[model samples]
Target chain A: MESTRPKWPWIVASALILVWTIFPILWIVMLSFKRPGEVGNQKGFLPKHWTWDNYRTVFRTDLFTAALVNSIGISMIATFAGVVFATLVAYAIARLEFPGKKLILSFALAIAMFPVVSLVGPLFDLWRDLGLYDTWPGLIIPYISFALPLAIWTLSAFFREIPWEMEQAAQVDGATSWQAFRKVIVPLAAPGVFTAAILTFFFCWNDFVFGISLTSSDRARPVPAALAFFTGASQFEQPTTAICAAAVVVTVPVVVIVLAFQRRIVAGLTSGAVKG
Target chain B: MAAITMKNIVKRYGDGFPAVNDVSLDVRDGEFMILVGPSGCGKSTLLRMIVGLEDITSGEMLIGERIVNRIAPRERNLSMVFQNYALYPHLTVYENIAFPLRLAKRPDEEVRRRVTETAGLLELTEHLDRKPSNLSGGQRQRVAMGRAIVRQADAFLFDEPLSNLDAKLRGQMRTEISRLQRRLGVTTVYVTHDQTEAMTLGDRVAVLRKGVLQQVGSPRELYEQPVNLFVAGFIGSPSMNFLPASVDGTSLSTPLGRFEMPGEQAAAAVGDRGVVLVGVRPEHFEDASLVSEDKRARGSIVQVPVDVTEWLGNELYAYVPYEAPADLAAQLRELSRELDSDQLRTQAVVSLDASSLIAEGTEAALWIDTSRIHLFDPATGENLTRDEDHAARLTRAAEPSRAAQRSTQQPTEP
Candidate 1:
């Protein structure tokens, strides 16, 4: 029945969704190329005069440059720590039969669903008291905590898909339990690990609430938070074009990462581990 | 290679259910031993216990001289081939076979030398660089065996390793595994539910029933002198047919007809019981027209209407349905279910020469070999006609040849 249906209706619906989601990104790219004074003219969707001057201004500013460095450092550190901890926790959840396993899983899920806005006020006061305000650790801690539940959930699911016999076979082949996990189970769970790491990195990179409320200066301010503090070259002009350029810069890495690992993120790595 | 001995090995799960209940067996050095039974019979559980994957609840498991009940699987040094051929998908065939050696921290040159030799023995040289996903089921199974053989472990355990292959490949791999086991001369304990594999590959076979060992013997002994009804029914294909019979002096009254047994045979079969079950192999019944007069004198003849006949070129099968008593019919049904067969009715399947003039819905004269028939006490399911002396002699005869093979191959062992 599906094969007999006309193809154009599906094609038309897909094109509509594509444009609805992609238009804002295309508009931002166009706005980034427009002249600084041209945003408020309201003449057309495309720029009347194309220029690289806004991009140059974005790079020349000390605030945006330092925030970019902070964003990369914090996101990378948080992703690494989150994935390492999640792998161990998820393996325990998937393979071991311990008491309180269900409680731990539910608690992690409740924490994931907890509102970020509610914690921002308490965390801000706590960071200040601990002398962690306006520091990289201030933002990194929350990013890792938030990223962990998601990473654990994804990794545990992948670990469950692996056949138990693979590890048993390895153990019978003379591998210690640790070696069985590191050499056999870890390689089998690589796709899940990669997917979890990418998700955690994105979560840390795109967070706004903690990035904005936790830090007061460029010392630990990420790009998403720094964008709100941008100003024009002088009092008469607006910073819309320069902000658009900075948005494009941060968005590039996310796009490249998804594109590069699209296969690994989606492929089921345990396909040939056992007969299906 | 070393002998593996299980002294009353028992495995109980957390729920306090004994999955393997007091199974004690001896796997001699450089011998191929098979554990066979229907599903859920604890054959695989026993194999796992031998390899230290499942902890023994109470018993001693010894590989060579060490009591290994508390030893880890890696420390026990026995490799296993899983039913699904659990090859590491991420590794090449070469690396997959070399995994154990690498885990042992072997040097690069030795790992290379041993893996190449094992791959060559398994005929996996051309697939050295290919991942397991790219290989066929048979190739993957060979890679799994290569991995087990490369370790030079104390023994090898196989848990239905060829169950996943297609029928033709299964036959080929069966012979290959048999040949490999013979060449390596490693003590092996293979678990399978398939009786044909049990009959063909093992130097000795052990049959289990619901976590209890029923009988362990040479396949010929299990066939000719089964200790009980379960062993008789489980060992044969187109298995032995059971018919309820009532004994009167030297004659037996069955659903088919009355047959006279010799005096000595009748005394052994009629042990304090008026009613007994007679077990007859399918091939023991022959078409009356095809039998010689002298041979016919040694057996009884019965005339029955054949309900169905199937000709398989070389032989013919004639199904003769009969009216069994209600209680005996239910008993046979339960036995059939336990044997993994669904026999819907009480019928005798008689195998005859293909040239016999037997057709559906026709009365045919079938000769039953009275000398070969077994009588069982229906209440206890015990074989009244079992000859223990003969069974022991059969097993004893097989020992010397096995010892000869081991001694001849000793010089080749490194």
Candidate 2:
């Protein structure tokens, strides 16, 4: 709407932001394709000698493959669990009337704001004592707990945006309570659910503190934690390029998810939902 | 279709404040009943209770002979149109209208046929495949109407359905709804806060104020013989003007002038020589030059300078501001507040004929019809010149045709 302003400022600002965000990922991808000797001996930002040796080495490791499977399986389970529970809680918070409703919202906010590192020490001690250490449930349980507040807050805002009269009209049109929920409300909330699932998956996928603190082996270690334990093809070889290859592989899912749901995520975050 | 009857219905919230207080009314079979009032008057609360969406704290609700207090909304066999249209955003017009039939597990063929047929009735055949989001406001409203009518439920409840539309579209939809109701002969209970909608759409309109039923009568009855000051000010377009008056024998003293009160109207006044409100509709006043000499002699004429005049094509409105006693001004202020209208001052509007040429700043002779004047008690806000029981009787008289039809096995007569 401010058409009088020069257009160059926005183009320059956009280029600066793109460089700022993409520089690190580009460096990692460049390193992933570099020879082991050339990684620490970089002549410039771009790799002088490129090879598939690092990617071959990363894919050939049992530990890396095992951790990749663990990360995918655990993050998916946690995302599903968190989103399902969040939907119920969000629906209650958004639609139903009860005492202490504000208290519930405040509680969710407090948990979301709570520092994850502060809970790591206690969680580590508890997991070990309960024999859940080095297990998939150990990581998944914390992932769900941490992801719930985000999912709940986002999903609840989305639920509140829906017109309540549509639900009542469904009932008056001869749908029972459950039918009304399934037939009318659920389809309307599908976009919000997708948005919540993506966010929860991203949270669980990118977690490092819980994965490292709770699991000592690849049995439950996610890719972020597993990347630290990567060894080269031999004891004398540096594993920097192999680790970079693994990091690049792990970032693929996040990129794919972001690209697939960029528009929906923007809508979910910005949808005030009060308009007709 | 069924007649809806409420017996001493009360809707009290959790805090024990009654939103709808001990209200009782019967909506006859196939009759268009309008529940109208200002916001927070409990008209919507009453409509919600009938549809089983809100709990009736203590009351008996009857759909024909069956009590529906314990029934759920779906089981109560009624349909409702919301002010927002409430159409499912995900469904096409065909699917939206077919939803109830599909819910009841009707045959797929039957659902398709009925949906197409209903869409045709609402003139939505061309947009049957379109979602609610793709349609315009008026089209979406019609789709909502199609959804309500597809199943032929026991009754249709409309909660200010036309309020979301523009004035022109609202006028169009109003006549469409009236035509649909007449063609279908479906029982309906509509709730709206607009007095114009209430006056035009209802076969019988019930006016409410502060959770109590103020008056229930035909539009003509409520307009011509209001039960109280609130109804008088609430019904008409340029609402009836209330001026402080004092009664002494047959003649009433008002800020405008002294006019002879008819014998029947004077007898309706309660105490002698007490302050009363004299209400005269705007249409009852005209330019003295426009009236016959014989008719002009039958009423009082007041010469007042017109502050402003509006020529509205069909009629002309002139505003005549006067000075009233402080107590009377305060009384009119309180009366306007109770009516949910703007604060009233010492103003009288004389709706003269368009040809009268009553220009502003000029003194105009305005003849008032003394017989049509309504007298009211300032303290109680009751109409002293209209019988409340007569208005009630007029409303109740609408129920016998339905009752007679229910009692006989013969087919209903037109």
Highest TM-score scorer: 1
Off by over 4 Å in 2: A272-275, B268-273, B387-414
**Local error of candidate 1 at A241, Å?**
1.0
Candidate 1 Cα misplacement greater than 4 A, ranges: A1-4, A268-276, B262-266, B401-414
Candidate 2 backbone collisions, by pair? none
Q: What TM-score does chain B alone reach in each candidate, compared with the true chain B?
A: 0.96, 0.93
lDDT, candidates in the order shown: 0.90, 0.87
TM-score of each: 0.96, 0.94
* Correct interface contacts retained, every candidate: 0.78, 0.80
10 residues in a row with least lDDT, candidate 2 chain B: B402-411
DockQ, prediction 2: 0.67
Q: DockQ scores for all the models shown?
A: 0.69, 0.67
Error in Å for residue B227 of model 2: 1.1
Tens-place lDDT digits, model 2, residues A158-264: 88888889789999999988898889877888788888999999999999999888999878999999999999989888999899999999999999989988988
What is the Å distance of residue B363 in model 2 from its true position?
2.1
